[model samples]
Target: MPPSAGVDRAPRAAWQAALRGAVLAVACLASTLAAAEGQPGTSIATSVASRPAPAQAAAQPAAIAQRIMVLERQGRARPQETAAEVDAEITRVAPFSAAHRELLTVQGLMLAEAADGAAAERSALALDDWHLHPGAQEAGLAAGAALLIRATFAAHGGHDLKRADALVQEALGRLPPEVSDLDRYRFVMVHGYIKDRAGQLEEAVRLHHQALALADQLGTPWRRAEARTALAYSYFGARQLERARQLSDEALALASEATDWVGLGRAHNTAGIVLDGLGDQDGQRFHFEQAIACAVRAGSKRDEARYLANMADFYLKKGEFRTALLHAQRALPLARELRDPDSELVALANIGFAHISMQHLPLGKRFVAQAIAIDEDRGALAGAASTWLELGGYLEQAGDLRGAVAAYHKHRKLMAGVLRADEQKAILAMQEQYDAEQRNRSLALPQREQQIKAEQLHRRDLQQLLWALAGGVSLLSFGVIVALLRRVRQANRLLSASNQVLRQHGERDPLTGLANRRAFQDEMKRRAADGMLCGTVYLIDVDHFKQINDHHGHAVGDAVLVEVAQRLRATLREDDLIVRWGGEEFLVLVQAMAGDHVDALAGRMLAALEGTPVAVQSRQVAVTASIGFATFPIGPASLPVPWERAVNLVDTAMYLAKAHGRNRAYGVRLRQAANDESLQAITGALEAAAQDGRVALTLLRTEGQAKPVEVAA
Candidate 1:
């Protein structure tokens, strides 16, 4: 049902790791120290002991802050040593002091790095006490950093994203105005990452751009590399492969020049994802290998695990199941040792898929069940849904039809539940926004009412004082009339604006921002009224879209649709009308053109989609569309065809294209002059009409083939 289940395709879990692995490397911003300054081997105890008692007393907090920064950098490689050092520092510092809070912040970051979520949350809550004594210097900054650590871990663990977003916002708000650019950059990157995970690609891109700007301002190559890598990942999620590749390459160069191993590892991983989407299997393999090398050189077990899983996925996709199994086995221990559930899950899923590919059915199903259990424990519905689908594919491949059907049904049910939950979240968001607006209006109402009363009192006073002055009274009356007219006009403007907003919302497909059926119907009606309904209509449907949703999850499916809409806009003329005609289908209306030109345009549309694979969630998915087109003003008699009938004809042709192996276009044209009777006969059965020579059909394919078919009635 989904292309032999799992042999050739990269598992969704591996793609997710590729897309998010860099987030671990960049989460702390302390890694930038290696490039900005020097190695982080300076001992805090020695530095403090060397200072005189008086100087130590004055600069103790600053020294502790520096040590915390160094530990953050070291914690990536030597987490246990760093944790011990942090504990010693915390023991020496005064409880709840600025230095103590800073140590607590670093502790939380380490705990999060180790994937100890409960511990991290406890640390975050402990840090929240800083809010009670907000007057302390640097209290907000320490608390904010801890909150961010918790937020990042939650987001990556596939926990509550909404809560994670709120945490990020809270952290941003808590940041002091005088914080360093590096601090702000970390916050922005984390914010962008959270937004990206939440399916807000445009917003995520904007935030990443802001981080890049901050990096440029900071003048650090490592910072720039991290920002570019992050931005590249965002672009990859949006299916802009070329842009992602360029950015990832730049990040690689910058990281290499700066000797920033963490940055280099992330850059290589990002480049691998882009190369995979570009269909350069060799290039992706090389990059993934380089990513693992960089991670090992950096001594970051967390990063090593992620990169190893990615490499295993690559080998799995290439049909090297044993190689994949070995790599996944290696990654699994590292993930479990780090207590990193995200990496652990990826490793488990890859192992499962590899085992299944190797004909170890029972073992594979056991591993898959473990992965699913992890997802359920974390309440990751999206992950669970895709895993269920993958299980279904495995069952189908094993020839267990009944088991496959049941698994598929479970997958569908889980996905439907996920979609409904997302809808409820969206509705809740809208309600909150509406409530906020209402509160603002309520707050302004009293002020407005007071101003109105003041104006009326002033007018009454002026009328009484000017009772004997006729000219003054007349001027007051005119002023009142002008005010009334202004108020009426203002109300009208507000009404018009509200109506415009409503119209736009009603007529647009929210997912792709394309015109919907209502807008298309309105356009058709307008065109008919203007007697200008002469154009070619094309109906395009994405091939195997349901399978994509089943294999990749709904989020990636939505990304595919959005990318397709963008590609359509890029390929078609600006004046052409594009609409989201139906689920996984698009309709385009081009200005009247000859049959040959229409065929050429249809070919362009097919090539636009099938030319390259779309990148989504760090995986490459090949997408193609089946299109059917027809130019109106039928037969040699120039019979005016109604828009509805024209649409029906093109729909038929679209189905024919689907029937003919897809990735192609079919065009319908009248063969000769036909009366109403013949037109009805032709419309009743399009293929029959073509077979009888009542119509001529043209076929164009992306494989560079074109032909005309006709028969005598």
Candidate 2:
């Protein structure tokens, strides 16, 4: 059997290699444990010696606190063992004592770290109960640390990002001004991790930098290693692979020097990811192996499961399906044991991909569906979208066209929701920017008025002075007044021009030079007021746009968008309203065209984009769009649909085109009068509605296809 064989039949050489790697990891863990035994707050023997003879019972609680602190510093590799120790200590201490509360806090942190959410929640509740009791000490660093742990777990689990973010904020507020640098560093790192998970990469990087600075002040190799690893993870998220590699390398070296087993494991894992991104497959594998070894030595089932899953993903990508399945199978049980849904998701996905590649279609699809179910339950929209796309590709490869199309549709729908949320955020940001500019203008107006008054008074004083003086002085003062007047007039003209420019910029997307959503809103409002809202709405989305940006660069992506905008302009009628809807989406409003003309226009738009490759950066890159279109007053009875609802219908249709395949168009039209219930049903389930004869749909493909369209009416 190969090194990647099943758990029971693992190769002897691989075992020996793993054991060799574990030597250093074990030494590091031992050194950390030894150091913990001598720390001021963690020395049980010292604590016991300090207590008076008659107060020996009181000393036992203090001793237990010291022991718990020691176990905490010893690393999280053996959370179960550490937890057992905590449980034993709890029995030794008086119930509800200060020491007992400290033990409860550690227990909560341990459970959360291990991904036991239910038990951790219970522990958090207990802590809350204790805090509410009379004469209980103010919730301090320990409570804050526990909350941070829970917040991190929540964010990583994809359970509730908003709640996790709120919890972190609360935890930060709870931290005392006099908290130690180490404690503050941990809190900052956790906060950064949460922010990164929340898609705030820049903020996460900034927070990680703050943590690094604090670690530098503390001047400990272990802390510095941890900080660098965290910052490296943020850089990885930002897709700065080279910078991440550099930081991860530095972190690894620092951790090795400090004999920090836990930090070493994390650095190794981060390095593996960066290496994989950089296409260093051998380096990636080695790092993952070392990470697993370190995790094993540290007694951390959670880390072990994660590293194994990552290894499985690497093998799966390399086309070693059986090897990948074996690794994933091993990881799945460990993840389940730790109750880590996130790691379980990774394992299941890898296993599914592997099985599908090996021709186990039904079994693979079931596993993939299970993973997606978990993602949906956890509200992990991005994860679900990616998984659906992957499944679609596999289905397509397996010649299951119908299944592939269905999977793609689900992927497109989820991705559309994600994009919509992102668009909303962008709109809010633009609104904020506009509001800020308005505030600046408001503040400047008073100052400008005051300056104008001051200038006028100075002019009057100068005129009086000139009158008091001679003819030459009067002429010079007149010249000065005239020059000042001209300058003021120039300033006013410049200000007006600036305001006009701001308005134009606000209404247009800078990248594509097309009217933006704000302009679209204004046009819609105008149409509504005039009672002339009877246009065909088309929603066009650039296909695989993010991939283009990632593979090429954002600069190239912008060029593509610019080219797309120009192509759209060339394809549509001059009277059509073209707007940069948001992101890689565009909206077009064609003034009341004939029904047949609308369909023809949709086909023309698709041809215009797919006909020629876009010329950008001296390279011809193929660009295509998925288009969805609908004409207003669409039914046989000519029932009017609101412009908003009409646009949404077209948006759904566009996704349908995307689901079917890119470089195509899908248009929706009502065959009968659309009541509210029927419209809702159609919008909610377009394909199903089409199948059941609730609406008519037209799918337009590129020129080379066998048929121009397949109309379901």
Candidate 3:
């Protein structure tokens, strides 16, 4: 196949090779455990045993290390080919000793692939092995490498922090007095990524700033871009949206200069996510696509999968079910092939969601259940919370209202717990840093007293006067307190209103004003539960929406969406719900409707959308909607075997309508209750008559007219 035709698939090969190399290198290191056991306490060990160096010296590497330091200084510095590549090459030249080799192997893997889990484990083992043979000679480079790798692992996996801290401490213990300024900066840069991921955001920001300063000193484009990117990511995770966007853009510009496609993709994706939070759907989608394009250029499957899933969800929210399903289908097989459980789980959940929008309730329900099961088995708390939220929607639609409520509440509780735990960890780290600072201040107070005493006295005097006011201040204090309380109450009210708005927004397509994919799933769940009663699910699509997007600008396409949503709303009853399952797809769930009633509803909806004039860019555009409907209790044959299966039937029917011609409604029916009753009666009469009237007879009829029924003989 041509590369352009298989753009998404090409990256899979490169990503697989990288991961394989990482896995094999790690395995090789792990297998070398016995060899690592006998190394005489080497260079790093001896350095730590001597009295620990001064604070400044402990913070930097020796000047003699300048040769190696130059290579390690920047993330993107050129052979003189990026700082990371230089660092890898430098490792080969400076020291091939056992301790350095262990460090090199770990650093090599990290520089080669930052997110490889197995490589991280191997690095940890190597570090542990070095500690086992600690001596004076092992202090500088070897010790620093150990600390850097351990921190990297912890940050990636959200693993043990105590071990990370200990390793960092050991590295600091061995920093030589004459170490180069450049080398120390690189060490800090490496440390920053780990700290950021470990939830130490403030520290992460500080370290990244230091890295930026060093990158400036080195004049390394790669280092600057990486530092900027890291800063952006850290800011985003910390909820500093504006700052993240600013840094991300800078990073992308620098990455462009270097042809760093992977970095560019990461920057775009990260920025896109922030834009999404800011309620810019078009901007988000555009950036997401840019990221996907870059990832493909870079030949990165993992990145591509990430982008595809993101884009799929975006389309799903836009009420384009067909497009969303296509992306989900594409992502699932890749996720499975890659053996990425997290990706696979997300893909499964997305697939289930698409099915639900099509009114294949049974099949949709099964898919969601499988996703939930996967999350639970893996002990993925966030995944579990997400699954629970989805399950709640299903139960709610299934008419298990109580179960739905419980599930929603459970999801809330889990999310709250995760947030609280993160907060607690942050607080603890801050407290420790504060305490350490206080201790440093106390120890330095006497030495600095003469120079700072006057400044301190002035501040103290100012504070004393502020505390000296009396009765006259009482009224003012009271008034101030009352005003503050009012402000607090106002803020609380605003927050509550905001949350409610968010919840409502969650169900709406931003561009179209149509119900989103989430709403469709919720509606489907409701209809499936009404299987015992009267409810019907309809799958609807905008005929040729892709061609529309291609010909018209997305902005105009959005206007068409808004117009269609308006038409749908007007045509549907107040009791019914219409969902934008994604892009050009819509789902309609109508209650108190029999098979024919649903078909009529679908036909009316199709006519309504087709008849409406969509004004976009001052032009009137004519479009049509295709609809398919499936009803429940459809009997043994037509009824969905599972809740999600119903979604499939409606989807299949909708496509059939589209296939027949545009702007039409296609519907599938369940067997009638009347037919079932007649069949039952006939069977009973035949049995009774054959038994020679041995069975008792009962006359049950409307308006006192007799309708004979026979009991068992």
Candidate number of the best lDDT: 1
Off by over 4 Å in 3: 1-118, 127-138, 158-191, 194-200, 237-239, 390-403, 409-713
* Candidate 2, 541-653: lDDT as tens digits: 99877556544554567788999999999988787899998778999998878877988888888888888998876878888999999888777877677665577678778
Where does the lowest 10-residue lDDT sum fall in candidate 1?
1-10
- In the predicted model 1, the residue pairs found to clash are none
- Residue pairs clashing, model 2: 77-298, 77-299, 77-300, 78-299
- Candidate 1 lDDT by residue in tens digits, 343-388: 6777788788788877787898788788778877877776777787
Q: Superposing every Cα of model 2 onto the true structure, what RMSD results?
A: 8.8
| Candidate rank order under TM-score | 2, 1, 3
- Give the total clashing residue pairs for model 1: 0
Each prediction's whole-model lDDT (CA): 0.70, 0.69, 0.54
Better of 1 and 2 by TM-score: 2
- Per-residue lDDT value at 429 in model 2: 68
Candidate 2 residue 400 Cα shift, in angstroms, is 0.9
Cα lDDT, model 3, residue 117: 61
